[model samples]
Target: MDPVLIMADDDSDHKIERRRGPSTSTLSFSGIIAVAGLLASGVATYNAVQNDIASLKRGELYQERTNERLSEELKSVRIEQRETMKEFNEKLDRIIDQWARGRKQ
Candidate 1:
């Protein structure tokens, strides 16, 4: 009895190797880039919010200073008006008293 033998010789027959699937490294690199892009966008949004808050604070401070100045001006104007009215009333009273004395004489 003789045993059957099988042998493969290089360049004698064409054999195709089936690929399993896509490479893991390619998918991993794509995922990493996506995460990095998301993180960068979040940082940019946070910085923009901070700058807006700072600007709002500055606007409020400016408004407060303007209100203080207006209040002081209003106080000064009231004082001047009171002084003018008092002087006018005193002069009218003196004129009326003199007229009454002349009538008696």
Candidate 2:
């Protein structure tokens, strides 16, 4: 193979030196660093996802509790309304009966 020629200085004496690139060890080390960075990024993403899931679960639980409280409130209101209607009906019946008796006399 022909050696690479490089001009060192602008002089009468010309020197030829082979061109050198990055060594194997340097390339391997750089590759390892890149892989490590990728792994770290993946771990960060996973942790973020887990945190989001936990937040969602907490929100769901809060909503469920709120729904239960509202349901209880609704049930109490219904019971109170039913009682009021029963009392009103009883009063109306008594009034009607009293009127009928008065008319008979």
Candidate 3:
């Protein structure tokens, strides 16, 4: 190669090298931070979803228990009403019989 041309090419290469210098370390650090942030966000989202599922399950269980309790209470009330109705009918029949006897006498 000619000396003058080689020297000019070396100078140009040096300028390009300087312009592109030492970027890998900065890019590597930035990539690491980005990955860390992504992982943290994913973990937080997973935990929130798990908590929501747990809450939904608990709510379902509570609703089921409430329904059972209401059904039992309704059954007890119906039984009591029937018993009361039976007693009232017996008393009414006795009153009618006594009134008829008194009228006949």
Over 1-105, each residue of candidate 1 has an lDDT whose tens digit, in order, gives 223223334344757589887589988998999999999999999999999999999999999999999999999999999999999999999999999999999
**TM-scores, one per candidate:** 0.65, 0.68, 0.70
Candidate 3's residue-wise lDDT over 1-105, tens digit each? Answer: 999888987787555334565588898999999999999999999999999999999999999999999999999999999999999999999999999999999
Off by over 4 Å in 1: 1-22, 98-105
Which of candidates 1 and 2 is the stronger one according to TM-score?
2
Candidate achieving higher lDDT, 1 or 3: 3
- Model 2 residue 22 CA deviation (Å) reads 2.2
Error at 28, model 1, angstroms: 1.7
Question: Over the stretch 1-105, how does candidate 2's per-residue lDDT look in tens digits?
Answer: 323333333343765578999999999999999999999999999999999999999999999999999999999999999999999999999999999999999
RMSD in order of candidates: 10.8, 6.2, 7.6
What's the residue-level lDDT of 83 in candidate 2?
A: 100
**Pairs clashing within candidate 1:** none
Task: Give Cα distance to truth, residue 94, candidate 3, Å.
Answer: 2.1
